[model samples]
Target chain A: MLRINTRSVQILGQQISHRRLSELSLLIFMMPALVLVIAFVIVPAAWAILISFTNQSLIGPNARNFSFIGLENYVRLFNDPGFWNSLGTSFIFVFGSAFLGQFVIGFSLALLLKYAGVLSRGIVGGSVLLAWVIPEIVAVYIWASVLNFQSGSANQILLAFGLEKQRWLIDMPLLSIIIVNIWRGTAFTMLLFSAALEAIPDTLYDAASVDGASRWERFRYITLPLIRYTILLDFILITMGTFSVFGMVFAMTGGGPLGRSEIIGVYIYRNAFEYREIGYGSAASVVMLIINLTLALVYLRFTRVEWSAEA
Target chain B: MHRSGNSLLLRLSEYGFYLPILVFFFGPISWLVLASINSDPGSAWQIPEQVTLNNYLQLVTESDLLLWMGNSTTLAVGTMTVTVILATLAAYPLSRVPFPGKGVFMYALLLARVMPITAVIIPIFSLSVQLNLVNTFTGAILILSAMQLPISLWIMKSFVDSIPIELEESAWLDGCNRLTGLIRIVFPLMSPGVAVTGLFAFLAAWGDFLIPLIILRSPTTFPIAMGLYRAFGDQGSVDFGFLTALSVLYSVPSILLYLFARQYLVKGMTAGSVKM
Candidate 1:
C-alpha cells in the first residue's frame, strides 16, 4: 500500500526490507512504556480480576495463599443490599453530573457562544476555562465552603437575599455533588460542542434562514444534527469520567451522612483500605470494570463512529 | 448566519443570556476570594463585614505551603514531560503506519485511558508497593503518566493523523528514518498539540487527590492537595481560615498556568475532542 514516489524514480530507490530490524527498534522505543503499563496497569489489573474469584486478603503475601472460591464473591455481591444501593448511587451520580447536568449547560453555553459575536465568544469561553483549569481538589474545597450549612458562602448569599439557607451537601448529597461536578466539568462539554458548532458551515444556516426557519427551527434541524456526533462523544467520555469520580466527592463529603454519596469508588476504597477486605474490593472493581465496559460498548454500538465519518 | 441589525430586544436578550452565567460561574469564585481575605473564619464564611490579609498570612506561616507548591510543580512538570514523549512515539505509528493489529492497539490504549482510575487504584497501589515505589514522587508520577497516557495518546494520534502523509513520505524517500522525520519536520508542526496535551497531562497529575492520598502515606511527600485535606479534615479542630487560604493558594498557581497557556490549552482541548 506504499505510494511510489515519482521523484525517487531517477535515483536508485532502495526497498527498505529491514522490517525485523525496524520492528525491533520500534519495540526498543516502546519497551519502557510497555513494561510500565504491563507491570503496573495490566498485570495488577489481571491479577485483581483473578483475585475477584478468590478469597484474598490485604495481608496475604502470595496470590497462591488465597483459596479459589469460585463465584462466591459475585454471588455474595448479588446478595449484598449495600452493593445495589452503591450501584444506584453511582448511576444517579453519573447521570446527574455528566448527562443531565453538564450536557444541558455545556450544550446551551456552546449554542449561546455560537449565536453571539466573536468578542463575546472569546470572553465567555476563556472565562469558563479558568474554572476548568483549577485542580479538582481545590475546586472541591471551594465548593465545600460554599456548600457549608451554617457559615458557608452559599448560605451567606441566600441570607443576603433574606432566604432560608439550603444545606447543599448535607441536605442534598447527590444534588450537591452533581452541581459541583457540573461546575468543574461543563467547560469540557462546552469546548467540544463549540468546536463541533464552529465546524458547521455558515451557508447551511444561511440556507435554513432563507427557507424562513425560525431560530429554534434552524437550531433543531441544523445545529443539533451537525453536532450530534460530538454530543455522543461527549456523553460517552463524560460517562466514563464521572463514573470513576472519587476526589471531588472525597474532598467535599467523603461519602458522608451514612454513606449517602458512596459510589463504587468510595465503596471499594473503603473495602480495600479501611476494612481490609482486599478480595471483596477486587471483586467490586471487577464488577465496576464490567459495568464500564458494557456501557462503553453500548455507546460505541449506538454512536457507530462510521456515522460521523463524513463530518 | 444572518446578522439582524442591533435592536433593543436583541440587546435585552444578550443581558438575559449573560445573567445566569455570571450568577452561577463568577459568584462562587468571587466568594472564595472574599472568604480567603477575611480575617475571621466564621464571619468570613458569612457575609464578610471586613477583609484582611490574615488568612493568607496564616496559611504561609502555619505549614509547609511552599514545599507543597514546589512538590506540585515538580510533579506536574515531570509527568507532562514523560507523558508527551511516550504518547508522541506511541501515537506516530498508530496514526501513520498501516501496521497489522493497529486497531486493537489503539483500542487498548483508549480503554486504558477511559477506564476508571479508581478501578485500577488498588491494583496500581499493590504494584507500587511491590516495586517499592510507594510514597515517592516518582511513584505518583508513574501512576499519573499511565492514567493520563490514554487521553494524551488519543489526542496526539488525531493531531498526527491530520498532518499530510506526503510530507513524511518525502522524508522517508530521502533515507530519513521515522524518528528523523518526526524530529525535524512533524514535531515542529505538532508542537502546539504537544504543548496543549502536556499542559493537560500536567494539570491532571497536579490536580489529582486520591492517588497521592492512597499511595503517599508519608507526610513529607504530601502534595498540596493531601496536605490541605489532611490538615483540614484530619485535625480534631477545624481551621476554616487556613483551609480557605490553602485552597486560594492552590487555585492561584493553576489559574496563573492557564492564563499563561490559555491559547494552546484551548486549541488543544477543542481539536483533541474531534475524535473523542
Candidate 2:
C-alpha cells in the first residue's frame, strides 16, 4: 500500500516517497507532539474524570492515596449552592460579555469599518485589538485602576460630571468584569465579522440596492445569510473562551466581595486550588469539560460543513 | 475589498460614530501609561505636574521584577522552541503524507485545541507533582508548548499545504535527499510560517498565568504575571506605581508582537483558513 510501503511508484508524474518519505519518518516526526498531547491534554482530561469520583485533595493523606467515593463529589456539587451560584455567574458572564458586549460591538465595528476610511479603520481596529493583545493581568490592572473606588478614572469622570462615584467593583462585580471582558474581547468578533463581510462582494449589495432594497433589506438578505456561520462559530468560540476566563476575574476581583463574580473558572479554582478539594474541583472540571467538548464537537462539524461548502 | 457609493455625508457620519467608540475603547488603557510615569500615582487618573522614572528605576533596582521577567522569558523561549520544532516536524508529513486515521487525528487535535484548559488543570497539577516537574521551568515550558501545539500544528500544516509540492519534487530530482531539500528549498520558504507559529507559542507561554500559578509554587519561580498579581494582592497597601509600571513593562513585548503580526493575526486566529 502507498500509505506505508515506499516501493518505486509514480503517481501523476510525482514520486510519493520523495515528498512524504517512509512511514518511519512520519512516526518519528509525529511521536513527539502526540506524546506531549497524550501526557498533558489527553491524559489529564481522562484523569480528571477519574479524579472526580474520588476524595482527592491538594494536601493531607488523600493527596496521594485518595480512594474512590462513588458519585458523592457529583452529588455534593449538585446540592451545593456555591456551585449553582458559580454556574449562574458563568452564564451571566458569558451572556453579558459574549452576546451583549463583544458580539454587538464587534459586529458594529466591522460594519462601520467596511465603509470607513483607511485611517479610521486602522486606528479603530488597532485600538480594539490592542486591548486584546495585552496580557490578561495587564488588562486586569488597567480595569482595576479604571474602576478603582477613590481615585480611579471612572470615578474621576463621575466627579467631573458632578455625579456620585459608585463602588464599581464592590457593588457591581459582575457588571465590572463583563465590561472588562468586553473591552478585552471585542476585537476577535470584529476581526471575524470583518473578514466575513469583506468576502461578501459589494456587487451583491449594489444589485440589491438597484432592486429597490433598502439598507436594512440589503443587510438582512445578503449580509446576514453570508455571515450566519461565522456568527455561530464566533458564539461557540467566545462562549468557551469567556467561560474559562480565570485570570482576568481572579486577578481583578478575586471573584470576590462574596463570590458575586465567581465564574466557573474561579469557582473551580476556589474549590481545587484555594479550598484544596481536588476531587470536588475535578467534579466541576468534568462538567466544564463536557460542556466545552459538546461545543467543540458542534464547532468541528459546523466548520466541516463550512469548509466543504467552500470547496 | 472596496465598495462604491460611499457618499461624503455617509463617510462623515461613519467618522462621527467612531468618536464615542474610540473614546470607550481607548479610554481604559490610558491609566496604565499615565500612572506608570505619574510621580504620585493613584487609583484615580491624574496628569502629573512632573513625569518621573522613579517607579521604573525602583522596580529595576529594588525588586525581584527582573528575576520574574527573566523566568517569563525563559518559559516563553523554551515553549516557543519546543512548540515550533515539534509543530514543524509534524506539519511536514501531515501536509504531504496520506495515511489511515489522519482525519481522526486532525479532529482529535481540534478537540484538544478547543477543550477548556480549566477542565484539566487539577489533573495537570497532580501530574506535575508526580513527575517531579513542580516548580520547574521544564514543566511549565513543556505544558505550555503542548497546550499551544494543537493550534500551532494546525497553523503549520496549513502553511505547508500552501507550499507548492512541485517545488519539493523538482528539488528531489536535484540529487538532494529530503533533509537537504527541506532545508535548502522548503525551509527558506517556511521561515515566515515558522516565525508566525513561534511568535504565537511565545505569546501564549508568556501570557499564561494558570499553569505558573498552580505548578510553580515559590515566589522565586514566579513569572512577571504572577508577580504582578501578588504585588497587587497585598490589598491593604497596594503600590499603584509599581503595579502600573510592571503592567506596562509586561505588556510591551506582546503589544510589539501584535503590531508586527496584526496582519497575520486574523488568519492565524481563524486557524489559517484565510489567505494573506
Candidate 3:
C-alpha cells in the first residue's frame, strides 16, 4: 500500500512539472512566430497606418523627416484621377477575372466532374492541374508568347485560318490580363469545388435524377444551393487572392498599353517601387487592406461563415 | 434513332466542354515547348525554324541560371524546414490546448495571410534595410518562411485535430511525456500532413517573385521568377526562346515535386479547408 501510494505521488508530481514545462516551452516556441508578426506584420502595418497621415517621399533620407499631414494624402487620393481610374480598373479586373471567371468555370467544372466517369474526370482534372502546377511566372511567359502581336503563335494560327491578326496586348489589355488570370487561377476553383461537391451526398443527385430533372435543372436546383456557401467562400478567397496578384499582370501586360490593365496591385507597385513614393505607396497599401478586410467581412456576413471549424 | 441522337448530343457537349479547357490550357504550354526548342530566338514569336536544344544549352553555358536554381532550391528547402518546425510546435497546442485568445491568434494569422505583401513591403523593406539584410539569401528565406507560416499552421492544426486525443492519452499512460508522445506517436500519423505542408511552403517560397524582386536586386540572388522577368524586360523586346527554355527548366523540379507529394496535398488541403 505504501509503495503504491509513493508511485501515485511521483506520477502526480511529474505531471505537474511536465505541465509547467509545456507552458514554458510553449512560450519559447511561440516566440519566433510572435516576434516575426511584431516585426514584419504588426509593426509594419502600424507604421503604414501612421505614415499614411504624413507627407513622406521616396527620396526622404529617413521616416523622421516626414511631417504629419492630417488626411491630406487621403483627400488627395480621393480627388486624384489616377486613384479613381485605378479603383474602377480594380473592380473590373477583380470581378471579371476572379468572380466571374474562376467561379463560373470552377462551378461548371465541378458539375461536369461529378457526372463524368472516373477516367474523363482524371484527364480533365489533370489538364487543369497542369496549368495550376506550372509557376505563375512561367504561365505568364507562356501567355505572353501566345499573346504576341507581330509573330505570335496566336497570330500564326489566326493567319492560317485567314483571320485578321489583331493586337491582343494593345487592343484588349484588361481582357488579356483577365484571360491569363483565369487560365492560371482556375485550378484553385476546380480543387475547391471538387471537395465541396463531394461533401454533397450522391443521394441528392439520384433523387433529382429520379424526379426527371434535367442536367441544367439539377444543377440549378440541387448543386447550386448545396455549394452556395462553398461558392461564397471561394469567391472571397479568390477575390482577395486576385486583388493581391502582381506577377501575371506584370508579365503579361506590365499593367500597360497605356495602363489599361492597371489593377491596384500593379498601380501600388509602380507608385512604391518605380516612382519611389514610399509614403504614398503605404497609403495605397493601407487602402488595399481596408478594401480586403471589408470584402472578407462582407463575405462572412452574407454567407454566415466562420473560419474556426478546424476543417 | 431518337435515343442515338440524345447520346450523340450528350457526347458532343462533353467533348465541347473539354475542348475549350484543352485549347486554352494546353495551347500555351505547347507553344512554350515549341518556343523552348526553337533555333532562332525571334522565331519563337514567329514560325519556328526547327526544334533545337540550343536554348536550354544556352541557359546553362551562358548565364547564372544554374545559380538561380541553386538559390531557389536552398531557400525552398530552408523555408520548408523552418516553417514545418515552427508551425508544428505552435499548431499542436492551438489544436489541443484550450488557451485563451486562440481564436484571436487564429484570426490574426488569417488576417496576415490576406494582407497583401505589397501593403507591408515598405516597412519590411525599411526593416530589412536597417538590418542590412537587403539582397541576402538568409533575409529572403526568413521572410518567406514567416510569410508562409500562418497558412501552414492552419493546415497542420487541422491534421492534428483528426487524430483522437485518446491516442496521445494512451501514450501518456505508457509513461510518455507530452513531447515524447507527440514525437513518437502523433508525429508518425501526421507525416502525410507534414509532407504536404512542406511541399506547399517549398513551392510558395520557390516560385515567389515580388519579395525577391524588391529585396534581392542583385542578379546573384535572383529566383527563377525574377530571373525570367529580367530576361524578358532587360532587352527592348522579349527573349522568347531563352525565356521559354528557362520556364521549361524551372517547371521540371516543381512538377516532379508535385508528383511526389500529390497524395499529401488532397489530405492537407481538406484539413486546410476548415479555415476557408
Query: Best-fitting candidate, measured by lDDT?
Result: 2
For model 2, how big is the CA root-mean-square deviation? 4.4
* Tens-digit lDDT track of model 2 for B161-263: 7899779766766666677777788777878889999999999989998899988779999999889888887779788788888888899999998777776
Q: Which residue pairs collide in model 2, if any? A: A151-B43, A151-B44, A152-B44
- Per-residue lDDT over A1-311 for candidate 1, one digit per residue giving the tens place of the 0 to 100 score: 98965767543244345533563466455556666566667776787798788777767553437788898988988898778888998899999989887888888888788778778776676667766887787787777767778677678878889999997877788888888888888888887787778788999989988999988899899887777777777788788879988888877887776788888898888888887777788899998988888776755554322222121
Q: TM-score per candidate, in order?
A: 0.89, 0.92, 0.91
Candidate 3: CAPRI quality band = acceptable
Q: What is the full ranking by DockQ, best candidate first?
A: 2, 3, 1
| RMSD (Å) of each candidate, 1 decimal | 4.0, 4.4, 3.8
Ranking by TM-score: 2, 3, 1
Among these predicted structures, which one has the highest DockQ?
Answer: 2
Candidate 1 segments whose C-alpha is farther than 4 A from its true place: A1-7, A10-13, A18-24, A60-64, A117-127, A160-162, A301-311, B1-14, B41-51, B169-182, B187-189, B259-276
Candidate 3 Cα errors over 4 Å, as ranges: A1-27, A60-64, A117-119, A299-311, B41-49, B263-276
lDDT of 3 by residue, A1-311 (tens): 43555765566576876676674565455677667666777788898888888777666564558788888878877887777777788889889988888878877787788778888788778777788888888887777768778777778778989999979989998988888888888878888888777878889989989999997898799878877777777788788888888877877787887778888878777887788877777788789889988875655454322345331
lDDT score for residue A203 of model 3: 92
Candidate 2 docking quality: incorrect, acceptable, medium or high: medium
